[model samples]
Target: MWGYMRPIKKAVFPVAGLGTRFLPATKVVPKELLAIIDRPLLQYAVDEAIEAGIEQFIFVTGRGKGAIEDYFDMAFELETTQIGRGKDISALHGTRMQPGQAVFLRQQEPLGLGHAIWCARHIVGDEPFAVLLPDEFMYGSPGCLAQMVAAYERLGGNLLCTLEIPIDQTSSYGVVDPGERHGAVVEIKGLVEKPAPGTAPSNLILPGRYILQPEIMQVLGRQEKGAGGEIQLTDAMAALIGSQPFNGLTFAGQRFDCGSKAGFIEANLALALDREDIGDHILAYAADLIATIQKGRGLSRDVA
Candidate 1:
């Protein structure tokens, strides 16, 4: 049914969203640059893609995103200054993309995720490409996309990273109508973009990761405004189901929706507690803070 999936060398990151949630902070720094522990959100996504064998990075950016481009480009003066000062240069190694491997496209309009993705269609060409939203950070053993890539090797047409969410919360995500289940992989019978509560087909929500065929670009091209009158990537994906082999990969990982304030803080705290350099200290500090808050509220000391 499937062979060892071809190595995915190209990844498309749609990062043109207006980070309205973060407000003033995002006014200067791109939301993708928000730090999760030590590295930026975009950097984590890039690292994961690299680990999954992605070599070419295609960033679909919008206005005021020059910082993102600069983040990946060589900082010649800074590197030279550090070298002259005898500072370690190793930290600068992972920040660069090899020649011809990084491409950027400007999404002139604040249309939608589908529009942002479509902006990179020419760069993606006809190869199978991976789409990662920097806002959704996944923590796992093998990396979320790597797991989906592994599944794609066997059944390759369009593969989505799916996770089970509370049925009551299905309206908040692109819900999947599952056909058949095989281990962690489910054949996608249909996909509905943020279906109304109780009207959702299934609780299998489409997170921010995708392994799609280039044909999706065509589907997106003719995509009519759905839901919020924006060209949704889910709608385009749904259009590809009958004509292609689309499956949902129930990934083994913890995903953080960094786009939301609560999810962002959770990701920071979770990753902070996993850091060897500061884990124990931060945990202790957090415990002390909780104790203080509890004492102030005249609550029980055995809260934990």
Candidate 2:
């Protein structure tokens, strides 16, 4: 049983951002290398892509992102040490990518998401590809990208994993002008990148995961800067709205915006609290912390 849509074989990870939000830590280490539980953020995104049947991994990186390249490569000395010590090497399995399976392209300038994706055009080569942003760490049963792939199989068009945000918060996200809703999938009438608060078309926002057709590359090639002074992917995607079968799939998952400091901490705690090895302990500590805070607030109220 083959689907009419070309199989999504490649996934693009735009890891070129300088991560200014992460500050000093990011100054030394690329933000994508930051960990949630035991896995680096990028690993989580890559794992999601792999789970979604993605074969080729395209990493659009910039200077100072060498660590990401090394992280995916085989660590010979570490593997040798683990072998000599007879330690379980299961942890190393995910880090190693098969030869020719991974390719890294340099995004020479600090452009934007659109330019970062455009950099992968040559390798993508007329195939429908997936774009997974590592900063948006999603925790779901089958993974967010897997869910989107399932939708893509049924819908067979450009699909953006979407979530309904408060109307006021729509200014922070790429707001979707929705047309019709067919269960979880919604027809995208238009896409507005960070629309002004009261002017947003809808409350639904594109969170990060996307299944885009190759024609978007052509749209982005001559695309002008939008929202910010950089070439925004939202603008390029918006240009293809009426021309293509554009839709939004509202995925069932908890998306953590690891790009922000608060969100990063929240992701770590949330994932950690779900782990078998440390869930109980973390839960207990959290309970105690909440109690202490509540007690302090009570005392303050009594004094007042």
Candidate 3:
């Protein structure tokens, strides 16, 4: 069994990013609160975690992120009103957590993803933990982390959910140096964070899901600023390869990068189009939009 493979009863979600790209909308509303359909981005993440048998939900948030805490708490007034009206409480199901099951930590600075994760060290204690970036949505049956947990049970050190991106685009992510290939799992030899074009070790880029050993906390503690003068978790993870057996699991699912504007819109449309409630309508609308765009482009070309 993977030495690092422990039942994933807890998960850490780092939601302290400035979300500068979203700008004023995010000034008051945490980007994690952005909705894809009827549920918020954070809600989808929490649901995924819950499905993976995660009992404790840990969020490392920043300033102006109080809404995130309230989102999981009991909305007293709303609940009271709903009860007063004798409305079905089922609508509120899955929104509230059992007392003490969910915890929140504040990452005072926007140092980096590593810093945000470090803020959760106290709550994580000395156990192997799972980290999920809310911006990266993984759609699958067993769930992304669930699969990682399974792989971890077999391989044991540090496990990351990796996927094959184009080689030219490897520079945009943490690329892994592949060692022994065993089906979907690959022994991780080394990791390079945002290597320059053509310098990446391999096209296997680390996605946002990870299951790491507690020893990583020590590595992050001593980690110096890398790349953009901010401590990168990838750098710290790279340090553990020689000491521990680190491997990457190529998951079976589609991962949506909800961090970018185009990706976010695409995720919204894709998920909406898959839902039985909205699929037909959303698909028709998308088809109409595409046709309109194509016609407009054709007319413009003819005029030119």
Candidate 4:
């Protein structure tokens, strides 16, 4: 139909995880508040939503996540200091939201993504809403959320971002059983979360970008625990497979798995190398670093 059933004006970011992978630092700072270059993880997710024409940002947070809210509010003391020092604060441009555009709700327990999303039900109301996982960073043309939105307009119903991974690695993500392919989008027949290794129907994995109908939220209310004895979003999504038009978009762009230490470093390197301001410098430095590392390995081999 080439049009969305309803305008997607709001996006939900589930940022309540303990982020134990990045402990110590995360103990003081929420993982979603961690920066990718100069912007926080949550900020990139928000910016992606903005590109998709989203007007509201709803955060499902837990304990020790107050900093996320503060980051969006005015800091009179900091602004005053910057003004007095004649220091430019333009970096903060587009960072603050107009009143009522941002909302934060506490997800009282560490249930699961489905539970966290259910916490924002009242705010989400009865329209389709987006769910973005801040830790899954994606940099793509049209942006991840925008691409999913575009596909939603054409297909209508449930749609999410998908990337093909090695088959054996499918156990690490929710696997989609594809029924048909249309260009970069795959029609979804079903979804299995973290299937046993070698048992996944397909390698395409869901990486935290979704346009789900309001019905899924109703399914989640049942709170049935799936894989990890938690209210799994995959289980709820599975219930809506044939009832509506559902599919996945193979978004075009570089994606970074910022959920781990290695992925985070890789994302930093890849993104830095693509930046106009730092590309050349980082390229030269990386080249030199690789050369030196290779030389050291050669010398060690000769000694052996």
Task: Tell me the tens digit of each residue's lDDT in model 3 across 20-80.
Answer: 8888889898999898887888888888888878899999998889999999989899989
Cα lDDT tens digits, model 1, 236-293, are: 9998888888998987989999999999999999998999999999999999889888
Tens digits of per-residue lDDT for model 2, 1-304: 1235788999999999999998899998999999898899999999999999999999999999999999999999999999999999998899999999999999999888999999999999989999999999888979999999898888887989999988998998898999989999999999999898699998999999999999999988995898878899999998888778888898898988899999999999998899999999999998987998888753244553
Pairs that collide in candidate 3 are: 2-155, 2-156, 3-156, 4-156
TM-score, every prediction: 0.95, 0.95, 0.94, 0.95
lDDT, residue 58, candidate 4: 94
Per-residue lDDT for 55 in model 4? 92
Of candidates 3 and 1, the better by TM-score: 1
Identify the runs in model 2 with alpha carbons over 4 angstroms from their true place.
Answer: 1-4, 297-304
**Ten-residue region with minimum lDDT total, candidate 1:** 1-10
Model 4, residue 127: C-alpha shift (Å):
1.0
Clashes of 1: 2
In TM-score terms, candidate 4 sits at: 0.95
Better of 1 and 2 by lDDT: 2
Shift of residue 85 alpha carbon in model 3, Å: 3.0
Q: Which ten residues in a row have the lowest lDDT in candidate 4?
A: 295-304
- Write candidate 4's Cα lDDT for 1-304 as tens digits: 4234897888999999999999999998999988888888888889999999999899999999999999999887998899899999988876788999999999999999899999999999998899999899999778999988887887888888889999988998898999889899988899999999889998899988999888888999998998888898988999888788788999798788899998888888888898999999999999987898888753244553
